[model samples]
Target: MNVSNATIEDVLNRLTNQTKLYFQRDNNTISVTATSPSTAQASPGQNKTVSGLITDATGEPIIGANIVEKGTTNGTVTDVDGNFTLQVSGNAVLQVSYIGYLAQEINTTDRTTIDITLAEDTQALDEVIVVGYGTARRSDLTGSISSVQGADLTSRSTQMLSTALQGQVAGVQVTRNSGGPGAQGTIRIRGVTTLSNNDPLVIVDGVPSSLNDVIAADVETMTVLKDAASAAIYGSRAAAGVILITTKRAKDRQFSFDYNYEYGIDRPTTRPTNGDVIDWMNVQNEVKWNDGASDPYSQYSQETIGSWLTNHAVDPYHYPNTDWMNLLLKKSTSHEQHMLSVTGGTEKLRTKSTFNYQKGDGYYESKSYERIAGRVNNDYLVNDWLRTNIDLDFSKSNAISPSQINPISHAYLASPYYPVQWEDGRYADTKDGENPLAALRLGGTNRQNYYKFGGKAQIDLTPLEGLTLTAIYAPRFAFTKGKKFTRAVPLYYENGSMTYMAAHRTTNLEETRND
Candidate 1:
């Protein structure tokens, strides 16, 4: 160390510490080697802090903002104060967004709180679709199945499934036979099948079934499996595709109920007219060859026939009890339907049950239908990983007396002079008139009874998040029994001889089961 003349290095050494070094080489200038406090500021590294007063494009403070990091699991929704703090990493991009505003991204390199204004994302995600056994984005589906969800059915005003599908599905047609309750609905998809009977197979929960299987309000969805690939799995009876019905499931903590109603008028078809041309030629032609030779109608004198045409107009035995056609017909018929359902579940058990009633009156004599149907579905969530389910469907339907007619030939065989009369004061049974009212009364009264009871149960073990193991059992029974009685009605032999009359009874039953 030079002490003479106060050399630069000697003076600098006294002032600078070991940590700070200051030196002069040729006694010309001094150099300093040390960290500048301004350049050595502390950093959070991967962690980021964003601080900015959110505001609208007009700079007014936005009350609440939601900020999320682009690709990681970090996200923070803004508070009511419209301010937010986001902690993110170095390589991370901070996403600032809100319900009404568009999203904005800023790199967290060296900034603290970045005040940002966001624009709304007008193009939101499309509707979420519920597909078979799973939910899909819709665009990714390559199959021919169509899913009809609960929300879609809830918006309709019909009581039955048949009414709901009308005018709703392309290539699917639903025809309601009449306006009365218990009226049957016919459905045809695409067109009639040719190779075999083309009727579609219906599956409820996994078992074959139909609209008769449950109330509309108790149903969750109806899926149409249209193509071979989706339907082939059901086999022999599935040529016409498949209708899969999913019944409402029990909720874990709430009891729910619903009701639906529809009221309308029954419009009918017009009746026949043209009352004049009875003439004489047509009746004569229809006479049986053996009897035609005898001119059976001419057997009645001209005066008698003239009297029948004016005053005894509607009779076969000098009585006005016959119009043949009118006796065999009916006027307008009407109906009503009501349905009730309740569904709910607890942590350990759940249930869904429904009751439905329908009544229909036909425009024809004694033609009517009445149905009473009930259903019960129960599920027990046995434990965290096990569950059991049960489904029951029962119904009774009956068709009332309606008119019977052979409109084609009734106009030809009856003689205007011969009157319609019965020994019992009821319209008599004549070869021509046939006494339609008598046939309904004494010819044979028919009573038919139909009953069906069906049920299914399954146990499920869900060991994984989305996988389930299932076992099922099913049993069903149906019966139709008819009783008829016809007292001594005449049976004529070919030789014009009368033979003995007869009475009979018919009955049948069907029962099925699966395990």
Candidate 2:
């Protein structure tokens, strides 16, 4: 059947004609009469059920609370299950009282179901201070080994494990000359350990390594070996102190998996300040002013300064004032990072695996980095006397550089009057000054590639009761390969660039056994 829309009057007429009336609820009070002497109906009571579960603020369950119908002296209490049920006489109130839980009172009405959630009393919920190593009553710790744990490392997309450690660990220092996945950070433990070799020894899963490829998400703990007792295990490499990095491995009898993702833009924390730029400009003017001229800016007469200011500052857009620094820096597009982890184990064998990917724009022009990595940590009980452990880590990365060219020379020595490009727009440069941008463009994406693997295995043989022999093996590798360029410019004209364009990689390995 076809139907047409109707106006308000038409809808009202149809409803009035077709609608039927029914019995209405009487505005009457419930009778207290039992109605019969043999089979009697009970009257409504004064109290209502105060049904609630008692729990601590941390969501932990609480048990054994006294619950009863108040004034009538009739009520039941919560059992070991932290739950209670009760019935009260007419108009009786209910009181819920518990030693560890706050006491609550409620009035009864014409209600069937009443539920309550009780909170822990102040005396029971008092704060308990924490002590590291093993929880002592905060008042017991005498030694100092600061603990740092809070912000989620998985949320931070730094490609290197060490990068995430910055500022979080006190007395432990991480220094990086530039940004990139494999750009090594000079790590020192509790200040410099030795006058000479200051770099602390890196230990992966309790085994020493000259180069350990660590994925940020896989790292669970970083402990600095400050004193002699901690350093004794490492021996020679420990002379400069020790850096122990522990990866997240599987726990026996439990199976777990997690996938975390984050997308964020990252750049320099502190850029070249305004004061730095001013100082640089002063140095440049002084360099030109030293050439027998009493005053600089003579090429553009002093009269031009007032006019330049009036025109530019009065209406900025109308008369442009060039700010090279602002033009050179901008917030690039947001970066994206994703990670997947799987860990599980049996009593005999435990295993862990993690995969991470990250990409972000670099601070300078034509710069960025992308990395993909996979790590597996495993433990196996070969026999009661024999056990083995292994951690395999591998990462591949590509870093995009602005130019392998001389950035400093182009930036510092380039003539302020000439600028980076002339009015003609062709790339401009001098014999002494070269644009770092050009050098970077020439080299393109010069990558610092890395392929790191750490393996550890041990054997334990019991020659007698409580007497055993152990053998261990570990190996590590790291490679930093890329092109660094410097053209014949104002800075590198003749004797200027001997130390420029120096790119070298360092690698190391370690192994041990005892009987």
* TM-score, every prediction: 0.57, 0.56
Lowest summed lDDT window (length 10), candidate 2:
504-513
For model 1 the TM-score comes to 0.57
- Candidate 2 clash figure, as a count: 21
What are the Cα lDDT values of the candidates?
Answer: 0.60, 0.56
| lDDT for each residue of candidate 1 in 311-403, tens digit (9 for 90 to 100) | 544543443434544444444445677778787878788888888877665554445667778888898887888989888889887755422
- lDDT at position 355, candidate 1: 84
Candidate 2 yields a Cα-based lDDT of 0.56
lDDT (Cα, tens digit) per residue for candidate 2, span 174-280: 78886643455677767766778887777656566543266666766555545665444556766766666666878887788889888776655665533332344
